[model samples]
Target: MMKRARQDAMVENAAPQTSQENKKQKTCFYGSAFSESDPHGSIDWGSLPHHVILRIFQCLPLVDRARASSVCRRWNEVFHIPDLWRRFEFELNQPATSYLKSTHPDLIQQIIKRHADHLQYVSFKVDSSTESAEAACNILSQLVNCSIKTLGLISTAKPSFMNVSKAHFASALTVVFVNSKSLSSIKIDDTPVDDPSLKVLVANNSDTLKLLKMSSCPHVSPAGVLCVADQCHGLKELALNYYILSDELLLALSSEKHVDLEHLRIDVVSENPGQVEFHTIKKQSWDAFVKHSPKVNIVMYFFLYEDEFDAFFREETPVTHLYFGRAVSKAMLGRIGLNCPRLIELVVCANGLQPLDDELIQIAQRCKNLTAMGLGECEVTCRGFIEFVKVCGGRLTQLSIMEEVLIPDNDYSLDRLHLEVSKHLGRMWFPDMMPTWMQFDAKVTKTLQVKCGIYT
Candidate 1:
């Protein structure tokens, strides 16, 4: 009888302990179960679902994500997820001077070792330091097994890639060019990427290549670009310096075998303004291209001086977008108004003190498809600007006129300028007032240079 009573007491004590343990396992630290809510709280963080942890890790930066993995074994698994490694920008910079926090070398190595093959859209953004460019090249060379679809080598400032040895840079670039068979888009502006590397790119990715932007690559010649045009029949978008543009390349692109080009950007830069004479694209060649790709957008960025523009806009051209980076002459603007009928967008960085009232009116009259216009250091009377808007009417989607561009006249002062302009635009419109701080901020100026295609 004594033994039986003791056994009943032991069973009663064990039952409550088991119940408490079960409750603790069911509830989370935040008073909720992984799958559902629980009233009796708390479980450890490790009990959370794998997907939830992966999602949180996705939002974190590379460094933070790596650090977070140390918190638990489950998070470490999430860190190795292939999806997280697909699109990554390798920010290479010198640690001492760069404002941007450089990616950890160990982490880069780890990524290359484990997840290089998983990367698809990859870009290397380096600062002005040659060390950073070299580091970027080293990383590029190691991506031999990567099947990247899009690759971009961007210099934060001052074409740092130029500082890298040409042989080294080309060799490193060819590693990806040879390996990534499905590369469709590449932006390698302001680099030392030569013709041979470009040929390698065409040989490997000719079938899949769609967009190629290599403006400011001084080493590529017209023949090199022609090679690409001939081989990469599926190329839809192309951007290169004016030096590489030629009648032969245009004819090749206009060939029936080639796909209808969607966009073509040419940077007309004058290293020695008066010394360099630009060759004109024959009207016949331009006609063929226009006929072949009726809806193609031909964008031209001119960084030439006043007199160097004589060869351009002398004949009928199909240039849809025109950007003048330097101070263009009044005569040049007049010529553009006459020749450029298909003009869709125009950005004039500087046009001297002469009021462009006649030219503005002429553009509104001639360019039927004109939709966007940006004027920086230019002149236009308030009446002339309002009249120009009135002529273009609701079709003018983007009209970015600096406040100073419009000189207040008797017909319209600064106060009533917006009202009259708004009436013509069919919506409220105001002149862009440049912030005083933007004048001193180099970063902002750089951004404007990119967006507006202004040189300085």
Candidate 2:
């Protein structure tokens, strides 16, 4: 009986010890589960240097980037870094159709408000609607009192949306340009704009507006442009499309007041060639037009045909940068190339094979200062490229070739042909070459992806 009592006492002691061990194990299991649920407690994010985090935030979109900044004061400070602003400018120019618009309009507005003040350029295409003016107004209002260096807007609208009154839109635009003290460039698109609106836009901003692009504004005719030329005497570049221009207007543009005009582009919508009055571009007229301006470096136009080029060349006209589509023939190219020794850039569209190899060779030989050459649909072989490269050597900085020579499939594959072509072209541009057809064909890596609906 004594031994039985001792055994019972020992069993009870062992039972309590077993229960205590079980309780300790259960606590450990729950503790491990809780630790996994909170990864910040387990992961050492503080180990990563702060600058690396800022770089990570810099790579994000403006919205996510802002969020990363708000996560901590260190990030908030880095978000305001000047280099990050440059990256933002570069990212903004990247094809805009790659982004997803924010679901929350207020969130987008806040994001825009934060960076709009820091922006040097704002390029956006808004859908044409009654809402578009309001949206544009909203965006511009944020940019008010900011130093906007460049502004480009492309608007697309349904047929019905275009019927709105100009005055109504003008009021909204006036608000946009109110305090843009440092606004330097302005590009507005195809809309029925009135002169008063334009006057208002240029009133305060004209002193600094060096570049102006006007599209589909019918009232921005030769007279209106002359007015602009008088107002913005410092204008360096002017691009116009679908504007009604006449000889009288061209005469006004030829005024000595526009001696600072360095780049000029004009495109007319009228099919009536006589309406443009080609006489305005005659040699004696151009000589008078350019007499006062010695700094005029670049002039590009889509007008003028074969006879016009011949006339201009025969008159001993000098054009520094010349671009002639299939309109001018090979003979004309040779004539002009022979005449204009100062021609530094030449762009020719191989149309109708007017400029044969011999003509191109002559131009290459004469235009000694030629720095850039663009050949589009010009039936040039490896022979032309190689010969031109040999002649131009270091002088050739930019060369664009659009045609691909297909090698025979019998003894050579497409890859080999492309490689050979690239090898030849690469030697010409050295380290600063564009991807030859071969490298573009071989590259198959995609590290980033974006999905955006096409608006334009």
lDDT of 2 by residue, 1-456 (tens): 999999999888874547556444434322431233454455333334567766787679777876777766776777776556532221111123324242246544544666556667766555534454445545554556465677776554432114445665566556656666656787875655567766776687777878877755664656566666767767887777524444444455567665457766555333444444343245554555456555566444444554444334664554666665434566676676677766777765444643256666666788787777665545544455455556776666666544332113454444454454345455423112334553322121010000010001
Give the total clashing residue pairs for model 1: 0
Local distance difference test values of all predictions, in order? 0.87, 0.55
Model 1 per-residue lDDT tens digits across residues 125-150? 99999999999999999998999999
Task: Give the worst 10-residue stretch by lDDT in candidate 1.
Answer: 440-449
Superposing every Cα of model 2 onto the true structure, what RMSD results?
A: 11.8
TM-scores of the candidates in the order shown:
0.88, 0.59
lDDT of 2: 0.55
TM-score, model 1 to reference: 0.88
lDDT of 1: 0.87
TM-score (C-alpha) between model 2 and the true structure: 0.59
